[model samples]
Target: MNPNEELCLCFHVTQRKVANYLRIENPRSASQLSDCYGAGTGCGWCRPFLKKMFDAHRAGITEADFPTSSDYAKSRSEYVKKGGGTPPPGATPVEDLPN
Candidate 1:
């Protein structure tokens, strides 16, 4: 198995684990995952791999489940707030955007 698969296997860390950390813990960036989950603290070797997992996890979410635009907007606003920018005008509200 690859290193990422190996870490995932050894830690039993799933895409869900990375996703939950991003969604619930709201890690603002890749470095934060290291602080939160020891995901990137090792020899600096697995950092990029961990980040890819996190990105993949976040990228896998869907937006159709949110019931309202306002709720979706709120989530989008939060993501942008964490992301350090105003959301683009064309940007879909949170629930609508790619995870």
Candidate 2:
């Protein structure tokens, strides 16, 4: 995924923003990313990506380690199957969320 691309669609948060947040705030866990303009709080599609980025950042990995957009979609599908995130109202099927 492009660093400037919208990672959290609902919040319009970008991967760069998340990266910067991680670098500056040094959140202890992935969930702490929510403090950064609620990056992983809405829709939940970006939660897995957020975690991946957070882990990579902590491990001193470069942004090149970030997963592709397709990978993020696939992982997010599995995450939804595992009941990892909360879908907002009217978000039936849980596969897609409102913009």
Candidate 3:
């Protein structure tokens, strides 16, 4: 996903925001990412991604590739359909993804 794209859809947190947080704050743990505008605290879709990014940062990798925004959104739609998460009212609505 693009750096400006929303990684945490529920809270509208971007990858850039998280990355900057990681770089500037040098958080001691991945959980500290939750402190970045309530990133992983939302519908749970971005938690794994956040952890991976955090790990990458720890490993000295500056950037990690992600699926296209379209693909990622579609996957989140499926995840929500399967009851994997409950997006809050202000979240980016789960789109009715095409098969």
19-73 per-residue lDDT for model 1 (tens digits)? 5567777665677876544544433333455676556546764221222434433
The TM-score measured for candidate 3 stands at 0.95
**TM-score of every prediction relative to native:** 0.39, 0.67, 0.95
Ranking by TM-score: 3, 2, 1
Winning model by TM-score: 3
User: What's the lDDT for candidate 2?
Assistant: 0.74
Return the lDDT, model 1, position 83: 58
Displacement of residue 31 (Cα, Å) in model 1 is 0.8
TM-score of 1: 0.39
lDDT of 3 by residue, 9-52 (tens): 99999999999999999999989999999998877989999999
lDDT of 3 at 18: 97
Best by lDDT: 3
**What's the residue-level lDDT of 39 in candidate 3?**
95
Error in Å for residue 91 of model 1: 42
Assess each prediction's global lDDT (C-alpha) against the native: 0.45, 0.74, 0.92
